[model samples]
Target: MVQVKVFDCEHEKDLEESMNKFLQKIDEKNILDIKYNVAAMVELDEDEQIYCFSAMILYRK
Candidate 1:
């Protein structure tokens, strides 16, 4: 299992889209049967300029 963390997102939608894109990219790269799952998220400040994300990826060898 591999853990992925994305930081400094502008918006929630952006994060979601980025995560989806990452999933597709990983799948295309054939990274050991990767799986996408959102673990945690946080928005910083009122402008939402900063964001934190955590995801879990399970890969089968």
Candidate 2:
């Protein structure tokens, strides 16, 4: 069956580490595709910016 796993993190390194750990437990042949994305936005009243790192894994087991 096909399934999707989603992950989100504040930093790119954190996202990469999390994805790597998950991938290690699964078969590489079962992976269909991986989608990654990043977005940045400023706080409502702050000068600092917030970053969002996210990814989606599509696979069949």
Candidate 3:
């Protein structure tokens, strides 16, 4: 089993969308091959008042 966490330099919403798109790419790339798994994404911050975004991805195999 393996777990992966990815962070993006984009906004939270953009990161979510981008992650979805990239996940599709990964599917097409055949990078994930397993029966047991868990994957999740979260936006830890969303404040235009700030100049940074905090996101988290949780995955398991």
Compare candidates 1 and 2 on lDDT and give the better one. Answer: 2
Give per-model TM-scores. 0.36, 0.95, 0.36
User: How do the residues 6-31 of candidate 1 rate in per-residue lDDT, one tens digit apiece?
Assistant: 43354567767776776665654445
- Summed over model 1, clashes come to 0
Question: Which of candidates 1 and 2 reaches a greater TM-score?
Answer: 2
Say which candidate scores most in TM-score. 2
Query: lDDT order of candidates, best first?
Result: 2, 1, 3
**lDDT per residue (tens digit) for residues 1-61 in model 2:** 9999999999999999999999998899999999999999999887899999999999997
How many clashes show up per model? 0, 0, 0
Tell me model 3's lDDT, rounded to 2 decimals. Answer: 0.48
Question: Model 2, 4: alpha-carbon shift in Å?
Answer: 0.5
Scanning candidate 2 in windows of ten residues, the lowest lDDT window is: 39-48
Q: Local distance difference test, per candidate?
A: 0.50, 0.96, 0.48
Better of 2 and 3 by TM-score: 2
